[model samples]
Target chain A: MEEVKAKMPRYYLAWAKDDAIRKKGANGGFVTATLVSALETDFIDVALVVKKKSVYEGIPVLTNDPEEIKECSGSLHCVPLNLTKYVVEYAAKKRIGLPTKPCDARGIIEQAKRRQVSLENVYMVGLNCGATLHPLRMREIAAYYGLDPDSVVREEIKEGKIFLVSDEEGKEKEKWMKIDELEEKGYGRRDACKSCVTKIPTMADLACGNWGSNDEKKTFVEVLTDKGETLFKNAVDSGYVAIEEAPGKGIETRQRIDAGMQKRAASWKEKMDALKALSRSERFEFYVGALKNCIHCGACKEVCPVCACEEDAKCTGLYDERDSYAISMYNLVRIFHLMDSCIHCGQCEDVCPVDIPLTLIQRRFSERMQRHLGYTPGMDVTKKPPLYETELGWSAEAE
Target chain B: MAEEEWEPKILAFCCNWCSYAGADAAGLERRQVPPTIRVIRVMCSGRIDPAFVLMGLLEGADAVLVTGCHIGDCHYVNANYKTRNRYEFLKEFVDELGLEPERLWLSWISASEGSLFAEMVREVTEKIKKIGPSPLRREWKK
Candidate 1:
């Protein structure tokens, strides 16, 4: 560990175990403490879909129910367990703080390259996601077990099964619960997360979790970037956490991540195949159907990193005094406006309530972008897009 | 907007010293060609941006035709390279948006190629007419 710390300081660091538990929403009191820390620090401006009770002393905090992140169609301001926009925006504006997950880090990188945010002063905290449960379904499952949704303790998911800790802290935790138990109890997840890829937050600077932990008290934290390393080292030095060499624990966590990724990839392949089989006209119909149910919530657009529209307050282009334009022209314009800039982060899909399958539509367009212009957004900040330049080899008057 | 629409609306963004001169020669020859085309002359084809092509399409033009100096013959040494690459890349980009790639055309008509200029316009006009109007043209917010 010392050798690694000395040699790869630029890309690696160590995280104390406690930081990992807080990432998982493990202890409500601990989570509240961390959330308070996140709130008080002006270093990172946080736009969270948080309960009013979660409010803190200082920070620019945008409040909404965290569950709102699921039904959003246009953009994602928070949720997806990553909180990328908050991390990146705050980092660029203020500097130094943690984003939620790996995917959030990717979103931050994409936004930064577009000059939407700066990456220099951000801490990308990664949570080891087994699978993101559909929020409503999770609530319903809690109800089925005679547990109030608000009273639900830590909900741990592993090996495709869900274990809900509904008892009070002094009560013995419930044993492992099966996905079938939730189903038999009449609860299902949001469709988006059920088909989501990326369980380990691959873009995070520092990923931590307890996916492989036998005890809920200990967490596995692995530093994947210099920024993460610096913060973790500081935390250790400041006596905020206890550090040690947990090589075996680290390997176990990594193996679980690998396994989870394989599962996610398989599911993604199935969803993509289903999407590909749809005709172009049918695909258009799908988007139209999705748009019809839109409540002008602006949740989707709000969460979008590509959505830099300042006029969102008025809902000018996407929403107007008249109903959001009936499907055709408005949607086309909106899609194109985002086409060149969208990073396909899937936040919009994750947030949409109507289950619009936004990621599917964006992926379809991204595929076309790759095939034609040979351009892929969010690949690198330095390389200019092919569309920004002119065609090569052909003369202006070759006819 | 007709299927057999011959209103070429050809946007010839040509370089001043080269393709623009060649365009002048085509007119001076008294060639009986369709006047449906609108030519915008500039100092160099290299000055054009892909955004201009997008703007032209959005503005109801049937086709955007760019003409520049042939390779090794640019007025601003290697200026033609920028034009060549820019248009080629944009051509693919337009196609990806489900737009008719044929609607956006690129060619090299040097100052010496007066006859080529006339022939190119006639050919591009016919091709664009066959393709008809751009979908974005229909959606244009009058």
Candidate 2:
């Protein structure tokens, strides 16, 4: 904490694997204390993240998990866990704060250039992310394994398998398991992570990891940018964070991890290709099946980022108790409404109780949109969709 | 080949400023263009939405033609540019959807080119008549 204060005293976000923090049990009291320290100052305001639906159609606020703050005004927003909310919040607030995650940093950079989110106020604190699983799915998998879903430690992700540690009698036994390995045992993940391309977090000011050492005891935080370099240097000189060059075992361990990831990537390509081969009609049937399993929870649409409706009245009765056909027709229109805007983030699939491959359906359509229109959603904010605007002989390059 | 009926339902979406005027001029001059052509005059060729064009085919139009002003001479500036790129995009889209891309067409016409307008109508009408109504729509009936 002293080290962090001796430095720039800027908003800092840190990402560390659970085990690294668990060695001291209270995460050496760093993460919570950092939040507390930031809250104490009027200059720094911290926002904790909670993801819900666009049903309310406003800033990302989470009503579920409430936290106590000393001085910082913390509000949750019902936005996706991706960098879109971070960027939007930063643009709206016009203040300096730290964001953690590699893709979040990349998303911010891409959005910032389009004036969607400005990076001028962002302090990019990147964590080397192999992937973020849909949290509820993690809980489900843990339950299937007969482990306390909440207690199972998700240690590391390498390619096709996740490495987890479970404690029995104060001793830890590590288990390496694939998603399919889990599925065969009766649990599956949301579809979006199946096609994820980035293994290491990208373009972050600093990158931290848990996979770098055989000892696997320490958080491997690397400064990848000038801002990160300065902050770490200050933090270290002031004793806020302990700093060290990774041991040789750390490098060796990470190499094996990288090789494992490469092997997984090859197999992932085959699985994703098969997933993509499902016809549009077949995918639509999947949606129908999902809706049939509906308790009318309305959670899927609620979490959907581009589903522009607020209340049940706004939703046009897709799920009336008596009218099943109306629901099917309503689902079709909803699919079209978000057909162009969906990023295939799989957040909706995660939120669905029926375990519908909602993300896969979106992926199928988004793939078609790209094939048909050469438009990849979320890549560029400037490209006006061919469907939305009047047809004129406009330059593909809008200059 | 002649045993199969060549009844072309050619949908010509013409811009009001130029192509529509050209079609009117062709009619006034009594040019011998095929009567199979159905001319729908829009505010601008550029004003035609791709969904409308796609829906026209889905509704069983044998051929769809989008006619607008020549480059740099749009009724509204750069409307033709949108028309061109959008048509090209739809062409690709049709190909990907396994529909015949040739069934869709784009051409440039002016208010004064009565002869040219007659020739375009005659040629497109002939091609569509030979190709017949979309098999995709025929399959949809079952």
Candidate 3:
């Protein structure tokens, strides 16, 4: 079998019989072919995929054209964009398909719980994501290694190594660094990515990844929902992809890989929880110290994937700049609102101009609250989060 | 330091059908309520958004009281259930923000429970006094 470039259709752990697509895509171009097939067959009216501008940059493009979908094949490890709000804002009523990282899939499901978007019309092809690089950090890593950051053509992080592959026309330079060494040097995946445990997007319709497969050119796809099955059959019937049954060992391998990634992330989470070492007043001081630098721009709230608030949100509406509170009403109300529904996606921290460690802060506040309530946001829409829950599921006296 | 003694400034939000009428009843019965509390009346306890409690804290109120009719006795029927739900969030949030848990409270005071309202105010004022001025308070000397 040669590189399978998108051409014809077939169904788990299968590669495109066409060599052109299989060679170009990270795995088997199954995701690209599926989206293309979905569009061509009118299964979905639109497909949203990130178009990579560079190793450090990608932008989400909403398109209905199969050729456009085919062109945006390979993934960019540095573009940590969440597509949940985009769907709510742009395609709430349309039949839509999009590739998702775990956070993106979780964010979308959170929006669905809030009734911002209807999950019935959305098809999520969840990509197995170990982690993503911060764009600025990637540039820094490139420059730190004596390479022009702009000249870098491809960046791959695999097996704990950061590989910088630079191609200027026909001239190519490839270098690799241990992720642990880079992290020691304060460069690598974003803190949220380091701490994130959602390696497999079980919340999505179909979970696709290279985790379990021994074949380097094929993808291991798990049909998680009925919608996933519909999508798989649609792509196969439309002749845009061909898949084979995954080998038995592949499933066990995937589980082992997931467990390993989770353990690593758990350690990172433990390491990053700064409040654990602080006294009660010191903890308060630490939070106030970090949050006081806020110019109250509301950028964090704006980019929050799970936040469904608009211009007149509770956070902004009651906040007075002149208030001399130890903490601003904006941060207070925002944190309060997120208590039950924060999916811990880290978009708020990503977009914060002041560089507040919001992922840590949000996780600190929400983790305890969610643990107490026995509620996990974004997993099941039927389970209303504790904030909105009318009856206290647990006794109030339990506190 | 000015050597002037500090007093707790409590901000209480009372629902109109129950707690607000109860506060009025307290006045009618000449109950000795603490002068520390400044009562704000709303038609329903559910009408008090969490922002209001946070705003009170930010406004230098040592304690913010959220009082409504008893659960299942809401004028709107089941609205106080929502209030209780929100109070749970407010309680966790206040604690997490590093404020003394005593600085925030939730209680049910019926329209006829004037003395209970007065007693609750006294209790809140005494507890807040023990905790000292709210850290969020802007010192007059400052």
Candidate 2's displacement at residue A292, Å, is 12
Clashes of 1: 40
The candidate scoring highest on DockQ is: 3
Which TM-score value belongs to model 2? 0.63
For residues B1-142, could you state the per-residue lDDT of candidate 1 as single tens digits?
6586346577779899899888888878876556767889888878886556666765677888988888778898877788776665565456544566688778888777788888888888888878776555544277
TM-score of chain B of each: 0.89, 0.88, 0.95
| CAPRI verdict (incorrect, acceptable, medium, high) for model 1 | incorrect
The best candidate in terms of lDDT: 3
Ranking by lDDT: 3, 1, 2
Candidate 2 residue A372 Cα shift, in angstroms, is 9.3
lDDT (Cα) of model 1: 0.56
Compared with the true structure, all predictions reach lDDT values of 0.56, 0.55, 0.86
In terms of lDDT, the poorest run of 10 residues in model 2 chain A is: A69-78
Error at A353, model 3, angstroms: 1.6
Q: Write the per-residue lDDT of candidate 1 for residues A1-399, one digit (tens) a residue.
A: 567667643322232234433343342112222223343443234424333221011123443222222112111111244455555444456554543544555566666665766666555556655444545566667676666666565555666576676655566446456764564444544333444455565566666665544445444566666666665555555443554455565576667666766675567546554456665445545555766676556677778765555454323443344532334333344455555556556667777777777776665655565555555555455654443443422344444
Tens-place lDDT digits, model 2, residues A238-286: 4445445566666676557756765664576456554456564453344
Task: Report DockQ per prediction, comma-separated.
Answer: 0.22, 0.19, 0.54
User: Top model by TM-score, which number?
Assistant: 3
